[model samples]
Target chain A: MQESVDLGPEQCTLLLGAGITGRVALSSPDGPHIVPVNYSVVGEAVIMRTSPYSVLGTYGRGSMLAFEVDWFDHERWRGWSVVVRGRANVVTDPLELDRIRTTWDPQPWAAGARNLYLRLHWSEISGRQIGVGWDPVETLPVRRAV
Target chain B: MQESVDLGPEQCTLLLGAGITGRVALSSPDGPHIVPVNYSVVGEAVIMRTSPYSVLGTYGRGSMLAFEVDWFDHERWRGWSVVVRGRANVVTDPLELDRIRTTWDPQPWAAGARNLYLRLHWSEISGRQIGVGWDPVETLPVRRAV
Candidate 1:
């Protein structure tokens, strides 16, 4: 199994819970690209599907990137966030595709968008927590559990 | 006017358009706090409001945090996203409070979920673009436009 880089509790639980996460990618001089994709935690990595015209189709292959997922409230004044930094690539192997399809159900927001599955291999993972007891902004060891 | 963090096109545009974005904070030993906030771009920063009991209040002074927004589709496979890194702090000053109140409209999904406004003084901002074009990943310097 590949070594997973686990940042912290803030970052780890987010992947475990199926939540909407943002996928950030680098644009080639023209513009910056952003996309919100559905993700599921498979062991130690984030797996999701992108569309054909979607940015994932173009940038999903061996691209340096960042992925973030977070939630917050104003009245309660408490929330948490997690960021995973690493390279994102396409999952082309048919066996892997079958596995992801069985485990993760990534559906498109709008109709007619093409679909492509991609995975982010996290290199550096870090996270922060707010409004629990005390001790915030703890960076976890690589792939260590909370 | 307060200084705006330099963000790439991806970050700026996403903050301006996406329907949902979230601010992530770390407070407890369990994990980072994640809350979905409704926000609008004012000047150059992302703004949102929370009540005294809000989780953001527990983040402490000079707390490190992030605000993220994005849009994506799986069919055609095209989308974009943006992330803002900055310090999370309460708005105690009257002028700041009035400004936040005047500019921000925190429409919580549930009633009484928001009341106070917290402005993140952004610092060291960076983001990337992916798959919008032929190139996969593009990393660029972040700057506020206009």
Candidate 2:
């Protein structure tokens, strides 16, 4: 963890929403298969769909994986990013899928809907935020208002 | 590509601007470093930045990497995602950095400025977008709008 790369509470608040998460897939010393997925954040975990035929299906489930979601506003010269380090596994419980389907919206844009939902339950959560004018004290006083 | 995945073109258009991009680092066998970054589309390439001492500085440069940027409007069930398969390396040359800096803004949010510009030169670029109401046909044409 570098001091220069610091993400504050304000930035972390933004990442809780349902955004497109970058799903990173690691090969077994073979090659690379990475995909962008639409996901919903549940508690400390990030969840998305999977295809049994895809590389993610092969490497991600029951494996250590990484998931990230970010937002940046250039005009304001400000941005925030969140990274979740965890193990990924396929969700098989019918009740879990039903609950997810009730609240979670899996917007698949590809040609196939395999409906293989995966969850990356975070073991370590770290983030950093960068902006032009971020006064810690100025923002600190506002925190008390909440 | 799965047929059940409904991706639309509007999602692609949104990802082209200064949106969120995730960098997946697979250096360590167990935990791959995933970081969210603010990025912009330069030609077909995805460009982003980080601090000099960031995790990306260690695992990112000269590595076979996967970069994905996406945005979703959950309320409308509309979103688009783009994934780039390429090698990521730090732009060392001052002229090259100058050119990238002109197009990409990698300023951090904390106190001091810590922006280390990098580019994911694409070897294979593919994207998918999905929208709710309209038929996937006219909204998400496969070809990139040049």
Candidate 3:
């Protein structure tokens, strides 16, 4: 085991853009819940579509949420994680929705009438990579969409 | 896209036991944060070690937190996730420490003085699998160790 290495802003943003799915951590009435959702990174904000009855749909609007994307290698005991913390808002504007839909839209995996779209405007981004000298971005199995 | 299938207790426990790494979501003064850690299941409780200043070590004790483990297949548009909602407790008993040390102790990946051990006693466990019928455990790239 080795001390984790802090990732810079560029590294954090690149890692977030590489993955299509990430976990969103939000505070609910019961407690904190982490739910995995497919998301798209447009500018610095994360955009996702969920059902109106879902946790993110219900309590995510105007709330501070943490979005995390991570991958680990058990063989080498190394992992890299990026967390984006910010306020979420419901995207109702037709123009903004059109831009996202044409460029990079988050396609929901679960089947339903997902009319609610939430955009998490990131205020803070941080990450860490564990293990010895190695470039996690180069070694990552998943690559950014071309 | 398809409707998510609810997983039963037996399936959920089996899935949780299969993974060595998972994300822990907890509430702090700042907001909700998700941190990935290597963990082990001793019966129904999750055993983990973290630094005293770490989020899990500081605010997690006696706090209701949500722990999640999941994997996704982008090509198939499928994934499975198991969530454990519970109250976390610090492990101080010498005897209990010995038991965990002897069997399935969580091996912390980040090197540091991790003197604090936290156990999350699950009060509620639930899971969901999305996409057409398929065993996520079977299709998962990472298999359980013998």
Q: After superposition on all CA atoms, what RMSD does each candidate show versus the true structure?
A: 13.6, 7.0, 1.5
B1-146 per-residue lDDT for model 2 (tens digits): 33335344444434444343345554554556666554656656667666667676666777776766555544455555566667777777888777666765544444544566667777765566554354433433223333
lDDT of 3 by residue, B1-146 (tens): 67788999999998998888999999888889888988988878988899999878888988989999998887788889999999999999999999877778899989888888889989999999998678877955566563
Task: Return whichever of 1 and 2 wins on lDDT.
Answer: 2
DockQ of each: 0.06, 0.30, 0.79
Ranking by TM-score: 3, 2, 1
lDDT score at residue A97, model 3, on the 0-100 scale: 97
**Top model number, DockQ:** 3
Off by over 4 Å in 1: A1-16, A134-146, B1-40, B43-146
Model 1: per-residue Cα lDDT over B37-56, one tens digit each? 55655555656666667656
Model 2 interface Cα RMSD in Å: 6.1
Q: Model 1, A43: alpha-carbon shift in Å?
A: 2.9
How well does each candidate reproduce the native contacts, as fnat? 0.03, 0.46, 0.86
By DockQ: ranked, best first: 3, 2, 1
Q: What is the TM-score of chain A alone in each candidate?
A: 0.72, 0.75, 0.95
Best of the two (2, 3) by lDDT: 3
Q: Give the top-scoring candidate (TM-score).
A: 3
> A85-108 in candidate 2: lDDT tens per residue?
788878889887777777665656
Clashes of each: 63, 25, 0
Per-residue C-alpha lDDT of model 1 across residues A21-84, encoded as one tens digit per residue: 4544333222333345657665456777767566557755576655666544334444455666
User: In candidate 3, which residue pairs clash?
Assistant: none
For model 3, the docking class works out as medium
